[model samples]
Target: MLEAAKAVFITSGVDAPAKEIADLAGVGVGTLYRHFPQRSDLVKAVFQREVDACVAAGPALSANHAPGTALTEWIDRYTEFLATKRGLATALHSGDPALEALPAYFMERVGPTLGALLDAAAASGEIRADVTPRDLLLAVAGLCAPVDHEGAAFSRRMVAFLMDGLRYGAVPPEPRG
Candidate 1:
C-alpha cells in the first residue's frame, strides 16, 4: 500500500483518492483504511518508507561502485527522493504534529547514511575533504527546491554541476615550474 501510495502521490499529489492507492496496491479500500485509518497516517507511512529506501540505498551503492561513482549515483537517488518529497510536503505540513515531526525524522534517518558515504568518499580521496553530509544535503535540497516538473533536466544539470564542484581539487595541481 505504501508503494502504491507513493506512485500515485507522485502523479496525483497526496490528496489522490484512497481508492486509487488501493486499486494500485491490488487491495480493497477497506484494506487500505484498515492499515492507514486516516489520510495523514497513509501520508506519513509513505514518507517514512521513502526515507528508509533512500537510507538503505547508501551502503549498497557504496559497496557496488567506486567512491566517486557511488556518491554521484547516490546524489541522483537523493534528487529523485527530493522530487517525491516535495510533492507530499504540502499535505504533510498541514498542521498535524505527528506529521510535522517528519523533517527531523528524515534527517535522523538520512543523516548518518549520507555521512558514511561522505566519509568513505573523502577517505578514498574521491572528493574534497571539507564537505560534510549536512553541506551536501542542504546544497542538494536547494538545487531541488521550488520543484518544477518541466525544469527537471535543468535541475539535474545543476546537481551534476554541484557534484563536479565537490570533486574540485580532488586531483592535486601539477607541480609548478
Candidate 2:
C-alpha cells in the first residue's frame, strides 16, 4: 500500500487526492485513511522511502564500480533525487509541522553513506582532501533550480565541471608562506 501511495505521489504530486492514492493502491478510502491518518503522514513515509533508496545506492555503486566512477554516478543520482523532490516541493513545504524535519532526516539518513563513499574516494586519492561530502551534496542541490527554469541545465553543467575537478591529482592553490 505504501508503495502504491508513493507511485501515485510521484506521478501526481503529493497534493494528489487521497482517493487517487486509494484507487491506485487498489484499496478503499477507509483503508487508506486507516493506514495513513493524514496527508502529511503519507508524504513523510514516501519521502523517507525515496531517501532510503538513495542512501542505499551509495554502497551498491561503490561495490560494483570504481571509487571515482561510483562517486560521479552517485552525484548524478543525488541530483536526480533532488529533482524529484522539487517535483514534490509543494507537498514538502505545505506548512506541515511534521514534514519540517525532512531536511534533518535526509542529513541523518543519507549523509553517512555519502561520507563513507567520499572518504573512500579521498583515501584512494580519487578526490581532494578539501572536498567534503557536503560540498558535493550542495553542488547537486544547486542543480535543483526552479522547475521549468532555464538555469537548471547551466547548473548541471557547473556541477559536472565541479565533479570533474574532484578527480585524482586535483591540486589546491599553493599558499604563500
Candidate 3:
C-alpha cells in the first residue's frame, strides 16, 4: 500500500488522490484510509521510505570500500537523492496544510544517519574535522539551488567540488585572535 502511494506520488505528485493510491495498491479506499488516515500521513510514509533507503546505503558503502572512497561514493549517491528530493521538497513546501510537518520529519530521520557516516569517515581520516553531516546537507541543498530542469548535472558537479574541498581542506585558516 505504501509502495502504491510512493508510485502515485512520484508520478502524479503528492496531491494525487487517495483513490488513485488505493487503486494502484489494489486495495480498497477504506483500507488506505485505515492505514493512513490523512493525506499527509501517506505522503510522509512514501518520503520516509526513500530517506531510509539512502540512510541505509551509507553504512553499506562504507563497509564495502575504503573510508575515503566510501565517503566519496556515498556523497555522490546523496547528491543523486537530493536531485530527486527537489521535487519532494517542492511538494512538502507547497504551503499545503497536509505536508506541513514533513520537513522536520525528513530531517529528523536522515540527519543523524548521515551524521554517523560523516563521523566514521572523519575518524578514518578521510575527511576534515570541521565537516559535519548538517554541513553536507546544506551543501547539497545549495547544489540544488538553481532551477530544477537542468540542475541535476550542475548540482552533481557542485557536489564533487564540495567533496573535494572537504577531503583536502580548501578553506583558509582563520588567524588567532
Clashes of each: 0, 0, 0
Specify the highest-TM-score model's number: 1
Error of 3 at 128 (Å): 2.1
Candidate 1: regions farther than 4 A off: 147-149, 171-177
The best-first sequence of candidates by lDDT reads 1, 2, 3
Best by lDDT: 1
Q: Flag the better candidate by TM-score, 2 or 3.
A: 2
Query: Residues 38-114, candidate 2, lDDT per residue (tens digit)?
Result: 88888888788889989999999999988778888888778767756765678778777989999899999888988
Scored against the true structure, residue 170 in model 2 reaches a CA lDDT of 54
* TM-score of each predicted structure versus truth: 0.90, 0.80, 0.73
Q: Which pairs of residues collide in candidate 3?
A: none
Model 2 RMSD in Å is 4.8
lDDT per model, in order?
A: 0.88, 0.79, 0.75
Worst 10 residues of 1 by lDDT: 167-176
Better of 1 and 2 by TM-score: 1
lDDT of 3: 0.75
Arranged by TM-score, best first: 1, 2, 3
